[model samples]
Target chain A: MSSLEELAQRVAEGDLEAFGGIYESLLDPLYRYFYWNLSSREEAEDLTEEAFLRCLLHIGRFDARKASFRSWAFRIAHNLLVDHIRRGKGLRKEELDANREADEPPLGETVEEEAEKRALRQALEELPSSQRQVLVMKYFSGMSNAEVARALGKSEGAVNALRHRALRKLGTILESRGWR
Target chain B: MSGRKSKEIKAALAEDLLRRVESPKAPQRLQVYGLQRILARAAYETRTVERRWFRNPALWRRAVVLPLTALLLLAAGTSGVYAASMDAPPGSALYGCKIFFERARVALTVSRSSDARLEMEFCERRLRELQGLPESGEYRAWERWSREYRRNLEGVDSLLDALPAEESAGLAARFQAQLEEHHALMEGLLKITPAPYLPYLQQASRECMERLQRLRHRHGMEEEERGQPRGPREEEGTTPVGDTGSEVQDGAEESGPCFPSPSYPQAELEDLAPYGEDTAPSGMAWTSDAEDNWGSSPKESNGVMGEGSGHEGKGSANHYWK
Candidate 1:
């Protein structure tokens, strides 16, 4: 069994210590996925924390045959993202991301590299929500097509199509912006 | 050339997107606080369920077996039943579950603005639940829900006060508008909601209206200082900007964050308190119930008061919390 599955089994069987293991594993991916989707890191963290709260509360209902704990947790995050957008945080949040950038530049990155990343964030924000979710899961969260599909409740083929479409549209946005 | 550009952009996009969320300390911080709270909550939930499970065989079927079947069914279908929680009212067996999710949300949300938003949502939800209570049969429920309603507004008040003047402006604008609507809604609810709820209803409506009035007064003062045009109300030349404050502002509470904000100073609230009454006027009064509703009494609520901790015994908004 996968580590997440093992952890879920442990948690389900009442070893609360496993909560830390599973939480550490999922935190980075889930936090990154949410941080990119929302404008403020604080808001992202709140939603991320909320998603885990739900996961812990509902761990018993989890079925490994249906989805991995990672994807199931991602599904919870996805629903929250949808609810957030529905509450009018969607398009309006993009307006805020126009100003905020990465917390710290990684080692040896250039000034222009930072600007390009900023432009790319703006571009990513413009992509449709489904496409963005697929990309964030596949690339940022390092989930497989099947895992992304399971998280979003879409077929793997549909997930692939979204990734393709997201990439095509992202390229168009970057080309038009010409941020060299 | 276009194809090459597309490839480079896509590659850069993927790489840069992955690099953006790199906060190292935040997760550890979250882990420290999140685990303890989640476990404490888990323990509390287990106890509540166990306590009830042993106490009532009838509730056992209702709480355990039925929910187990529902959880199985929901494992595939709508996951919302558990997440948003069943709309279990105050005394329902699943009500503890409902409150557990709310506490987790509030406990997990450390950001001031996020907390304000969540409190706004909760206060609004509490009001809606109260409205739908159908009759005066549930006085305890009414008291519990209304107390939460008051606590939420106080939470919002404290959060907004804590925000820097610049940061609070936009959010306060939105909140002032919302509180206005809530004030109106509560006024309407007071008239229609049944009799047994009169004192609580009267207190709620008055509190709602007074809070709206104070925020509006502060908001107006800020606009004036910024040298912007007066609000539509003042522009209409009808409401004497501080008419309410001038007549009825509470004297002892001026030191509270509620009144002396942005443009107005604490002395100004004192100046406005023409009457000798030490108590706040209407919605401005923070009662013994000012402490929030997360199973914490007013005294215990001060534990997380953070910056507002100084105002503890001084009858700042914390005075209203019980």
Candidate 2:
């Protein structure tokens, strides 16, 4: 069996050491995934922990044939993100306001470049959740289209279409800002 | 630039935009701590199965059927004509009868204690074990046990459902009375505790077996008994054998045994008890710099190789906005 499968087997068998190892290995990636979506360091950390707890709880149901351990984990993380967003318990408007305030540049840079980046972030925030998700997974986390599709429970074709539409909208936003 | 080049440029821009969007890094301690908390939770959750097992002793008794059957067959070989006759066809009604009696005997032995909590715990444990069996045509007893077990579970579900949403505060009392009724009904089935009571358990088992045998004999085939026809109202009465309304009402009035609270406190986030020390990191970390920044450093991004890099590559950039 592959290493991940072995880890999963150990996890199912209630091996804490194996679980810890798996947690250590996957924590960074999962934290990044949550952080990108939630955009708050604190919320991302909490959600990442929540996701791992959920994974531990549901380890018995993990079917390796359907998806890799990483994919399954990300799916859990994605669901946790959705739950966090829905609850609005931690970091919603506060995060956006914080980001807007922090966008103030310390070093000298061209106004056009700063404007473009700010516009891009705004455009990203404005895109439909599906489109935004595709962009986040594809570009931010560096997952392949296939992986993103599997994580999102969508067809690869659908992911590609989403990416295309998201990029087009982003281009339009940038063009309107006279940054293109 | 050609349309293709424009597309390439757009892709680069998207990549750069993403590169600029920093991914948050959790403190190493928090990751470790969270994992420990989860492991602790898992350990605690494992006890739920044990609790379920303790709640039903019939399941445990039924689990021993195969072993008891083997022992009985072995004993019969050296015994008299009656003993010889006791060894009916393996899947025959008579065989099921013997197993049922053996189960009653075992249940009686285990459930001798007057402690309702202990009895309930044993019954629940047995029930959990029975529910774990794979349903198959060959395991006829198992099938019957599964049906009864499911009915019992539904009864419990319904009983809990009948309660008001805020009844969690009074759950102990409710569970206690429900447990008492289950214990009483099971005690009625198995009377092996007091020295004089052994015969009663044996008699009850024998009666149940005889009834089952007559039912099977009337059908004339094992398959017919396996798929016994049900009356239209059969499902309505399928509540657990012991769940009378008085028992439920009594449970509501008398507080049952106090169980540990299910909800973990948010303040105890780092305390992964019983499993090990809480290795999880608190969100705050002491850094070498004079300034206390709660956010950890976003690991250095090695831009996707061969991908057109869009952002100005800057080392040591903090990922968090703050």
Candidate 3:
């Protein structure tokens, strides 16, 4: 079994300590996912903490046969993001990806590389929720194509198709915006 | 760009985007405090689930059952404490469990309507505890329960605001009915309660009733906003303007019976009083047998307070206080 599955089993069996390991492993990706949507650091932290709290409470009902722990946790995060946005807590679609690139450049990358990364994030956000989710699970959360498929309840071929389309769309967006 | 160059750039951009997303570090305090809350709650939930499995014989097949000897010993040790703690007052040793149970119920409740009812029920529990505290003649305990009562009322108000129109209407009606009963009970107690403690108790009851009324008005307005008719309970002329904080008179304005006769004898209540030599504790005044039926829905003749009433498990809005 994978480490996440192992930790989830331990947690479901009432080993409270195993939760810390799970939290450490998942916090960054979950935080980033929220931050990318919210564009606010404190709100991201609050939502991330809430997601973990929910995971702890309902962990007993988790069935490993259905999905991996990472997917389950991300699903919780996804639902929370949807709920938050539904409640009018989210920014407008244009507001979401517009300002992320305006922030400080990453430490080592050149201006061109930073601009390219910014445009990619913008295009990713602009994609449909399904495609964006696949990209996020694969790249941001570090899931493999198969893992992403399992998380998304899709086939590996389907996931590859989504990645190809997402990358192609990002390139078109960059070219339209005058990037190489 | 050529196909090979495009692939290389895609890979590099993916890496950069992923890096950008992970760069902002959450402060250590936020992480530690969050984990602490989760750990404490998990411990409480685990114990509660175990305690439940022990009593429920039907669950024996799927559950992790301990040996008979160990089971009996465990039940003897924990159940006694838990049961005692269920009735524990604010200053007592097992009082923490009462708080934990409330918090856990809120956390575990997945439905918004059910969560709202739990908050309302906990507010009532706090009020019940507050009424009982003065019976012990422990002024400190009375103060503590009073504080908790205020906090719980605030919790109820917030829950009511967050609830959808249908759920809020049911809970608001139930809360209004219960508050009327509590008001009458307090009026009876006020005659004999100690001079110093009377104002706090009176104010607490008044504030709770007022808050419930405000919630009722808010829910009524929300229903109107949705083009739904006002409930049968609302007075025809008095529309709930925003934040009016109107008064709810205890007469025919309420839909159901206002104050039923006290189920317990006045003499028994007098015997439990803390202050006056001849009078009983103020808490005993409200704990009369009639109060137990306050949580029961109006339609149910059985007066069993939502258990197995066909509204218990389902997400029915009529489940008064789950």
| Model number with the top lDDT | 1
lDDT of 2 at B182: 39
In CAPRI terms, model 1 is classed as incorrect
Candidate 3 lDDT over A1-180, as tens digits, reads 249888989988978789889988888778767765665566777898889888998998888898888878887888888888889876566655455545555467677666555666566667676677766766666777877777666799998988877766655565566655
State the local distance difference test value for candidate 1.
0.66
Tell me the TM-score that candidate 2 gets on chain A alone: 0.79
Runs of candidate 2 with Cα error greater than 4 angstroms are A89-91, A99-121, A174-180, B1-8, B20-22, B48-322
Error of 1 at B113 (Å): 74
Model 3 stretches with alpha carbons more than 4 Å out: A91-117, B1-31, B40-322
Residue A69, candidate 3: Cα error in Å is 1.8
Report per-candidate DockQ: 0.12, 0.22, 0.13
Candidate 1 residues lying further than 4 Å off, grouped into runs, are A91-113, B1-28, B44-322
How closely does chain A match the true chain A in each prediction, as TM-score? 0.90, 0.79, 0.80
Candidates in order have lDDT scores of 0.66, 0.51, 0.62
Evaluation by lDDT, superior candidate among 1 and 3? 1
Q: B185-238, model 1: which lDDT tens digit per residue?
A: 655554445433433555555455556666766877898999999867556543
Top-DockQ candidate index: 2
